[model samples]
Target chain A: MNAMLDAAWAVFVRELRLALRRPAEATQPLVFYCVLALLFPLGLAAQDVGLRAFAPAIVWVSALLAALLGIERLFRADVDDGTLEQWLLADVPFPMLVGAKLAAQWLLIAAPLIVAAPLIALALNLQPQAIGVLLLGLLFGTPVLVFSGGFAAALTVGAPRAGLLIPILVLPMMCPALIFGAGAVRAAQVGLSVEGPLYFLAAMMVLSLTLLPWAAAGALRNALE
Target chain B: MSGLSKRQKRMAAVLVLVLGVGGAAFLGFTAFSKNMMYFYTPSDLLAGAAKEGATLQLGGLVEKGSLRREDGLKIVFVMADCEKQMPVRYEGILPDLFREGQGVVATGKLGIDPVTGERTFVASQILAKHDENYMPPQVAASLKTADGKHSCAPFKSLGRPAENLAGKPMTAAAEAPRS
Candidate 1:
């Protein structure tokens, strides 16, 4: 009821507060995303035409990789400090609490990546209209990344040195999102209708947001046991 | 609404979310079903799937002897699906992999031949279809008849020209024959 929502709100607030406490952690993936995108213009000798041609792919790949950067730490700190056990014992539904934490991660991690993407895409010479489609693609695509990555993070929360394991486990599952996300931008850049890829991405985000929180909660229980 | 139990409210929210997403996906799928074809075959164009003057991708095998390279970069070729064939005219430096009897996809508009009043696909850009192992022309021709499997043949080792020349419009100087 109201109590569950209040508890979920409290957990979300706490997660955001913790992220603010370590501001570098929140900004690190964004910096990684920007740097990866910025490197393409320097490395490629071609002028604006070549850079613009590759802009959508570069921006999408960098965003996908950057999303992975913060996912490993998604549940690690709570597991380390025994806060996960407290969450399990709380009266609110455990999945709701996990969803709230993931929402916070999406805000702190994926949101920044999306916000910073247009700037990076512009640097790569992507057109303004294409940049709008790029933004929309990331808006729908990144939540799926966060939720799916959070599930992988949850699965590996108890594993020692699980840094590289999360991306390896989740990247294959996240391929469709990457394809549709990048395809939308490419279609827009080439003056094709972007609705198809954007719809697929939106469907994926809805399905992920609906289902992954419970899946992650189940994985957390397995790790706890 | 305020008196509803929390469980009922949760169900309502979940129902709304699912229905909303499902409706949007359904609408988009229906609206874009025509545009989403990877590339339209000659049969598709002949059947009137695309309107005249609208840009689209035309894909098929280049007929074995139908290639005519005019002066400069202008080339005319017959692109064939299993059921029908269409003539495509393009003015560009053909990709390195461009060859007769290989699969190709051209992006451009469908126009009418002014003299003959016949349909012509005027391509702005031409790309060689890239596949790992191409079937020979005979096998591809037979396969196209039997099961309608269009395989790119004879052009090996070339990456997709689409990727190489994406968003790079070539110079189209009205080189297509008027007749």
Candidate 2:
């Protein structure tokens, strides 16, 4: 148990260090997200109506894009430095390593998006009632993103043009997450029920948690070999 | 040519051959498939010979004032190609990105005599093509473009590994807090 914990912690610390080392790169998604949100008001004709109408999608799209922006680095640096091979060759199990990196990724990338979502919501003209749902939706959605991203990262680990491939493969899988997360906010924005989409989001999180790490590690092993 | 090692030359030659064959095959298939992914403008969709149960993708600006919510959960939005409008019914919450004016693409089987398209979409994948540069490189490059539509290779195709942008400057410091 202690060994497993150590491996996970090591990966988290390593990723965090890299993120801190290059603050500009690390913060790109958040900036992109906020800037894009600003476009809503300028582009639309009516602020009040457009704000209510566009709020759900703005939050989800920003979150999804932000998630994608952080993905390439998940394995790129490790592969270049030969560290990925070292981890695979090490005594620690690959799944644990996968788990740790995923956790770190969520903390570094997804966590920030969630924090920034309220600002996005405010920009989009979302009601206060819907803000909590947006946050919760992100809470559920980012894990699925991290899990799915791990698989894509593993698949394209050494593939040429992987930066482009990750988004392509990932956006398709993001359908369910986008639907449910945005659904929750839309439901609350106009005083509707939230149970169904929230449940769906929860289900996706549970499934991704249980299955994605192993699949991701398997992809990593394939790329490594 | 001057920098090439014999072993590296062999690898490069093999790569060129693979790329040539793969690119040819993809182009051939796309032509054969009638260039499957044509984004139907709202008016185009209505004018088309949309037979019952024919699978199709409708793309256009989401119509304003046409949004109707059922219990504030199920959403129906209009896709207008400025000439015609097709109704897209989505269950569950939408993304913060889904607004009336934005361009959207919805994929599903055409409803049976207009069966609300519910049962069909419920069992199928309804996705929006948010951007033109979306498909994975291999898939895009491999896809048959017979109809000559969807031929825009907007993304810098498969030149670098995904990580090239990881350390690229974000052009904004506000993206990540220093802490």
Q: Which candidate gets the maximum TM-score versus the true structure?
A: 1
Q: Residue A212, candidate 1: how far off, in angstroms?
A: 0.9
lDDT of 1 by residue, B1-179 (tens): 23457687678668856875676567555435424456777766777666676667888778767898888988888887544689888898788878876678899989986545778999998898865645678755554432223343222111222234332211222212212
Per-model TM values vs. the true structure:
0.70, 0.56
Best by DockQ: 1
Per-residue lDDT value at A86 in model 1:
96
lDDT tens digits, residue span A1-24, model 1 = 677788899999999998899888
Off by over 4 Å in 1: A46-48, B1-34, B41-57, B61-76, B80-86, B89-179
lDDT of 2 by residue, A75-123 (tens): 8778888887988986666766887888888888888888988887887
Q: Name the weakest run of 10 consecutive residues (lDDT summed) in model 2 chain A.
A: A187-196
Give the alpha carbon lDDT tens digit for every residue of B62-161 in model 2: 5556767766676666655433456676676455656655555576544532446332222133344454445666665564332212211111112222
Alpha-carbon lDDT of model 1: 0.77
